[model samples]
Target: MPELPDVEGFRQVLLTCRGRRSVTDVDVRDAGVLRGVSEERLRKELEGRRLGKAWRHGKWLFVPTGDGPTLVFHFGMTGSLRCCDQEEPIEAHDRIVLTLGGERLLCYRDQRKLQGVRLADSADVDRILEGLGPDALAVDRDEFLELLSGRRGAVKSALMDQSVVAGLGNLLCDEILWRARVAPRTSTRSLSEKTLRRIHAAMGRVLATSVRDGCVPPRRSWLTGRRDDSEPVCPRCGTSMRSTRIAGRRTVWCPHCQN
Candidate 1:
């Protein structure tokens, strides 16, 4: 799953490759990766428009064009964007291609063909994003603390809920919990003010680190580094790591360190 860090890296890809380039051709190899807009409409709307600045909110990437259209992309489970020359051999899964400025080609690739792309006018984009809570990277301490007040769900579930804080996925959820010394299953209401404050601080630190690294780097020091081991040991402590499902998503936590 491409999370906040990965999508932030993709935003950089757009910055380096597509910004200021005029779309000369639009090719939809697999229309399944498109939502709400048809292939014909996509081609008509995108071609000839110059890609302006790009932005990201959580896992969604927004590329605005000069013509007032925003190209919205949700990289469901296995989707990514790349920039290459048109002469480069296209991968089999590259679903959409935007030829830019007669030199560069931007490709939207996905293996599972899950959540794909959409085009929205400014107003439509606002409506689409209306229900999402404050972005994890953008929320202030007071807002974060207020959001967690009175919640009964496990802290991990609360953190991963997009409505609670956008952009936190399973890995981020576990990492933040582990850093805050909060067990993954600890109920939100059980958390004291001091502990909740720690969690908020940890969230900001971890998110800043991940974004700086361009992804949640799986370094030996990070919990992500050991999450997939068949018999994983905690990187912070010597105890064996545990794996379970929380909120229907696979979760990894260090039993000794998190609690």
Candidate 2:
């Protein structure tokens, strides 16, 4: 699934394609990827509006068009945003296309159609985002500590819960736990302040690098890089890594390093 870093990259794509340009047309190739709004309404609302500065919260991307409705995107497992030349071939998965000033195409491509587009007013946007916690990229260490301190459940589960801290997916939670040398199954309430601080620091470092790279990079030295090996080994301790399901997601951790 596309995580926070991936969604951030999509925001950049939107910004690049929408710079000072008005939407010349709206084409909904697959209405299955749209939610709450009809194709006619989407076209009617956004066809000629100028796109404002796009922003992201957690995994959601919001594109405001001046005083009009906001265009919201949630890139599910196989969704992405792309900017292509007007003459370029549209991929089979390009569900929605926005012609910008008739000069370029902004495409919303999704293979799975699990999540897709929505049109929201200010109040609707608020209600849509009301269930989410503080964005992972913006939460401070003290706030992170407090959020986890009040939670009960495995530490990994807490991290993956959007209501507890948004933007962390299975991969990010595993990477953060591995870097912090904390076991995935450790109880949130059992974590000492020092351990929680370490986890927060690891999250910061991991998110910083991931955001810059636009994904959780699979660098050889990182656990993410080695998780898929035929016989995966801990990059730090060289012990064979362990894999199990935690919070209903496959988790990879180093028994020797994280014990």
Candidate 3:
């Protein structure tokens, strides 16, 4: 699944391809990738509008067109945004293509088509984002602690919950808990303030590097680097790692280190 870092990278693609440039054409190669808006409406709303600054919150990317509607993207599992040459052949998964000033093509490509695109006005944007909690990258330590304090499930579940702290997915939650030395099954309500603070700090450091790299880089020193090993071991302590399901997703941790 495309997470916050991947979505942030897509925002950069939007800015680099279309910032300040007017959309000369809109092609809906697959209308099934659109939400609520018709193909004709999408083309009508965006054709001659200048794209403003693009922003990202959690895994969602938003592109505003000055006074026109904002284009919202939620890259579910196999979705991505690509900037390619207009002369290049469209891939099999290119669902929508937007021509920027007749120079380049911005493609919305997805294999699964789980979540696609939406066109929203200012009010619609607000309503769409109202259900999400504060973005994981923007929440302060105190606010992070407060947000987890009210949760009643495992700490991993709380971190992965979009309603509790938007943006964290399965890989991120496991990595954060490992760095904080917190077990995956640890209850959020039983956590101490100091522990919560540690988790918050780990999240900051992880997100900073991940956002810069545009993915959860599988570094040898990081848990992600070893999680897929035939028999994964902790990079720090060399203890054999364990895996189980939590929040209906595969969860991995080092029993010795996290204990």
Best by lDDT, which number? 2
lDDT of 1 by residue, 120-187 (tens): 99897898678677889999989999999989989998988877788988888888898898889999
Per-residue lDDT tens digits for candidate 2, residues 1-259, read 6899999999999888748599999999999998999999999999889988999999999999998999999998899999989999998999999999989899999999999999999998998789899999999989998898877789999999898788999889999999999999999999999999999999999999999999999999999999889999999989999999998999999999896
Greater TM-score among 1 and 2 belongs to 2
Candidate 1 all-Cα RMSD: 1.2
TM-score of 2: 0.97
Q: TM-score each candidate.
A: 0.96, 0.97, 0.96
Give the worst 10-residue stretch by lDDT in candidate 3.
Answer: 12-21
Cα lDDT tens digits for candidate 3, 55-154: 8888888999888999999999889999988899999899999999898899999999999999999898898688788999999999998888877789
Task: Sort by lDDT, best first.
Answer: 2, 3, 1
Pairs of residues clashing in candidate 2: none
Which of candidates 2 and 3 reaches a greater TM-score? 2
**CA shift at 145, candidate 1, in angstroms?**
0.4
Q: Which ten residues in a row have the lowest lDDT in candidate 1?
A: 124-133
- Clashing residue pairs found in predicted model 1: none
